[model samples]
Target: MPALLIDRPTCPATQLHSARRLIAEERLHTLFQPIVSLDCGVIYGHEALVRGPAGSPLEMPDALFAAGRAEGLSMELEIRCALQAMKDWSQLQRPGKLLINMSAAALSQATADGRWQRGLGICEDYGLQPTELMIELTEHERVADIDALRRGLTLLRRLGVGVALDDFGDGRSSLRLWSEIQPNLVKIDKYFTRELPAHAEKLQTFRALLQLAETFGAQLVAEGIEQPEELRVLRDLGVSYGQGWLLGHPSSSGASEAAPAALQVLASKEIAVMPELRRAGGSGITAEKLMMPAPAISDQASHEQLYRFFTEHEDQHAVAVINAAQQPVALIDRAQFISRWAKPFFMDLYGRRPCTLYANPSPLIVDADTGIEALTRVLTSADQRYLREGFIISRQGRYLGLGTGEQLVRSVTEARIEAARHANPLTFLPGNIPLSQHIGRLLSSGREFVAAYADLNQFKPFNDQYGYWRGDEMIRLVARVIGAHCDSQRDFVGHVGGDDFVMLFQSDDWEQRCEQIVGRFNELARNLFDAEALEAGGIMAEDREGNLRFHPCTTLSIGAVRVAPGRLHRAEDVASAAAAAKRQAKHGALAVYVMAA
Candidate 1:
């Protein structure tokens, strides 16, 4: 075959003119690529990439900036780029920070030309505060004046604009600049991320960088991540933020709204592996465990192609339609698409057209790390169309796969039923089985925690005089009070049957939280009795030996045991300590006794 013909600008002058015209007319466009949080499976921010007009000589970012630099218009070009990026970002209304690139030279020039204020004005016009924007110094040029740069950055910081040092570890001066500026974020260059898993020395260097970031309290973002192995290494090393082709690419119109696929892959791996490593108890299940490989059709697929797909795979209830970058743009319901095709002349009229022309443009997109309970709630509250069409599961906003409503409902139901089997009947809280498992998992993970055992004092007499139904109501009320006072994110509350309960607090504020629970329970306990009993502060009831006596109202006694890592090897050890503390607490009404060292 003959060589393929390609078009190119014939002269250097023409390309320069194009670059100049691009600046004069303000025709530069901004594209945004997502920066994702690997652990959470969410988009943390987006880095804006500037591109010239399609098919233009300055279309590529490096060429665009280099052309302007050669023409002595680098400062002007960068200012215009920032303005355009801010305006478009405001219009797009994305949730995270908008990271705009600026070279160190441009920063000095903008401050000199009074152009930085105009940039701030543009931000104000779009209802964006400085806090929402991050100015990333590309660090391609040496700092001409360290004092001047520091003064400019200080001003930006005062206005709530965060500074990020980009291309870290690329030069000898990178560390010096980092110390001088003390930026809030640092982006590691792609060289270290490339083939990271195969290079042990590179891993060690990355680990050192991570430690450096920690010392300065700056977040480290690994850039140019393109492979699964690279992502795995980054995640294992505890890298906080990441960006690259493996996550999502830049889009001219705006940032690609789809989640990153790497997040789903990492989450799936965690769901499959982490539980096994800590399965001394029942493992906490995530949505990824229930997720099946998403059935997907390309966004460019013809109507006939979709029809054939549905015909061949009769079991497929729905399929995600994805763009060229593997980002899901729409979802097609199998039955609905087939029903339309079943109409007379449907194939002849639209068979050759793209499937996207007829697919549902909006589908429910969920992160793979979403819990089963949370997933169930989202699906139940969704529109009927989405429920019928199924939903797309993403990692950080990139498409991973599709999940059917049937699968979600079934998984949630099974999880709920299994939980119900181990739930306390009175308070409907997790019973002894789950409580033991929760403590076991925490111990296995080597986490320092406080385990408190709560028991009701004078409860036998209160139950005898107040009937079992009333006593059950009191137990439920106590459960609610404890739950209200505990940190839901870091604490576990369980009912160990009868009037006994267990609390596992992982937060440093566990002491204050436990005190609050004790105080609140005492205040609410009086309300459970009648007016006479409330005034007297006790109810007359028969003792175990058949003697009549005045019994105080039911009071809570908490026995707390602080379990340090390596101190206790099993849940039962912690339980024994807490039980001993409980014995001490029962001597007084609404008392809390911390176990002695």
Candidate 2:
């Protein structure tokens, strides 16, 4: 949908002709996009992506494919690209999986003694195991003959090659197809994952799809997860596999050295203490180290003790009744203590004889080894709502003091808040606070870096027309697109607010990332607008002359600058230079201008 001219001649016809020449010349290349394991957070494998000549007219791979299809040379170009990708990938084959793109039409297109079989045999000749290969089928293309497609897929599967249904939900395929040709994996379309956290419907749809994937015995991958919230939610939903710009971008070699700074999750000391607690059975001690004092119910002991415990320990909603053996047998409440215990019935029955209603009817017990996750669920259950009043705590058969639900939640909430502040809210990037420290740390250790500044073109006018609610959503969407492009590289991105953002990357791949973000943002944003607005060329609105005028839609402009040690002393200086260059780029259509300095 987005057009990019990588190395087009001055003339349009000549440009098309050049693309044909490049393909026929077999000057195309390939790149690898790493797909990491979500569980252990390690690089599991890489997806092989096609690329054209260094200065070819087809700059972007998607644009190249579109051109190839239009020229009726899709299969030829695809085969050449796949072979090149495999050859490029073979040089760096680690103990990782290799994913290759396969067009259904290409595979189903009678190619027995043809190039397709020859390519497979070549892979075998190279000693690449079929099990190590994963063929990803395109969802946009029509499967002219389902039976033929199935037969080819079956043949590949029998050879131990894995089959993945790419962009599963973006197409019109049904549950019937899922039941019939169950894929080894389903890559959820980025369209669904991009705005999942903010959009409840998308989140629910993803959850349901995850269930469907699990039901069909297929591994589910939540693709296009570019935001921290989206990633966190997907992890919580138990989607076992994932791939997207957020996880990692497609690279030429597929080997990545580090996780992107924004994605680097900081493990808390308290989290480390969890395993130690488990090993020791449980955290037997609370903040107050002293044994929990029992609530005195004696007629002489005033309600002051009960009130103090309740107010002081916000965590303990329910008080426990301690027996002479120092073990808690029953739990009590302040209300029960006042209405039932302090009643004249106890004094009337006898300051000497035993009273019946002083103790609660039903009490709940918990062991020391009980985990926080299970404990939270148990306390929240209807049957155990009363247990939140106070639950009996025990360790190795020895009774400990009473604990309540209030304490645990407060602790967990505080920990989560501390963890979330590591990134900026607007751009969802590592903020100035974190970025400065990271830069200082890297600089102090003598690491080289490059800084880039990105800004949106005509965003204010678009926001004015769309209203702030949708405007905020647009900003968020663009942030995700930018963040997605960064992937898991050792990069730093931050929001200077509004339609502006910044990134610090080590490699020269910043331009490629900028191009991808701008292209994808325009495509997706156009789709988000109404059909009438899209048909109007541009939305009509009041101009400065008080007449209806159509304002141009928004686009992005990015500026990149090198951050060599002596050249750039501070991050802000580099950012300032980039911002100026970005202003120059805004005068054109989504361009990346490099700072001469």
Candidate 3:
């Protein structure tokens, strides 16, 4: 039947006619790709991609949409694509939601043209409720009327139809659009997902965007994930949904479930060794680290566009207008714009004028790479205006995102909590939390490691005799010794607590390092003690029984456990096994025990 359609068009002149005939003849077909839940390993939904008849000139979506746009029939063409997908998806009897793509222009036009009503009718015809469908906004065409688009989407969402923004963080995707539309899900661009394990900047971007998603009460769908490593990283980032060839390929047969191998990857307990933020030259955290989703627009845009943008994005406190060079030109406060816009004759006089008429051309605009510390010291940075009306965040004079005093303070506060988890205060080494976290990364990466548990012996009695201040000095001595012996590049040394430390050794000479650590700690142990305790060979202190007794001087006991790949499922399990080995080492004469786990 498809063969009866016109042969692939060879001339540009025939493209429009071919598109019209393609729609008239109902030549479009739908392909479904399963979007799977990263956390639960279930099929979340299927995105329906429309294609023209096989071997036709319009077989590819980009060509087909281009033809439609060129012919001024995009609204008709998009409706046909969506309605056919709905018809085919209903026939496939697939569970979960069915997602269809629509250009913002077409969506806005559909509101008054009744084409959307026809789509709703198609859903009902298939016994599918409005809730079963999701309209994903594609960036194929620019949106000319922001208010119309918002109203159209609002109507659909009101009727239980889900809304999403496709290829987010790509092309002209605006944070203002994100804030204004409040999509149920945002499909992250493939650029960020590709080779994600090697890109720390991408990881940090996703982390910030994830926080933005949470703030808006929406989920993120990482798209174009073609590697198991990418999928693992997305899972670690707590992304809700994922769509890519790694999970399932788009097929005409409409495979609604993930493939067996992909399912296995999802079900695995492996944690991704997520790329960590590395600062060059010990640079402090930059302004980029604290960025949330704030949208920017071109200065050439009209005031009506700005007005509609503010009306749609009530949650957004501010919007930045950038020049053609992508440098920020002005900042628009939501309240200020709306208040001025509400005045009598304001819309009648300036609705169509350039938005810069009302914009603050001298508003705060900071480079994205500006250090967070420098930002806090700026005059009036502590003022309430920036908290309510955010400033532009740019990189090399080009807009990157937005920031505010409120989020800056919040980010610093949150970072302190993370800093505490990453390192212990007294010892200033990696803390217990990072100890387990690194173990998990090693186990997931299939790397062999030695888990060395170090404990200070008779430390309570020593503390009782010398007091906490002296005990702290003793603990510091142990930390210094342990840190000095291990290869900082390949091994992790963590101060779990007072007198207790953990080392995950990836070095080949781990055993030698352990022995050196024990010898070094014992050598330094005497210096923390007074002459009287040193002369007595041990200190007089109460034991666990609370009886006054002569206790041995503080000495370090080292327990080493060799952990091979796949020997443990959980990092905590490895930790427990190592701790068990430590107890055995404490009883041994050598004060160091090495055993396979």
* TM-scores for every candidate against the unseen true structure: 0.44, 0.42, 0.55
Worst 10 residues of 2 by lDDT: 268-277
Model 2, residue 534: C-alpha shift (Å): 54
**How do the residues 154-240 of candidate 2 rate in per-residue lDDT, one tens digit apiece?**
877777878777777886655666677788877788888885655657766877887888788898766776665566556545677
Residue pairs with backbone overlap in model 1: 258-397, 258-398, 259-396, 259-397, 259-398, 260-396, 260-397, 260-398, 294-402
**Which is better, 1 or 3, measured by TM-score?**
3
Residue 332 of model 2 has an lDDT of: 66
> Which stretches of model 1 miss by more than 4 angstroms?
1-17, 253-260, 269-597
* Predictions in order: lDDT: 0.77, 0.62, 0.81
Backbone clash count for every predicted candidate, in the order shown? 9, 5, 2
Per-residue error for 475 in candidate 2, Å, reads 31
Better of 1 and 2 by lDDT: 1
Writing each residue's lDDT as its tens digit, candidate 1 over 61-167 gives 88898887787777777777887888778878778888999878778777666677767776677787788889999854577888878877877888788999888
Candidate 2: stretches off by over 4 Å: 1-19, 110-114, 171-174, 256-263, 266-597
What's the true lDDT of residue 416 in model 3?
56
Candidate 3 per-residue lDDT over residues 85-183, each given as its tens digit: 888888888789899998898788776776677668766877878899999998833877788888999889888899998999886788888888899
Quote model 3's TM-score: 0.55
Better of 2 and 3 by lDDT: 3
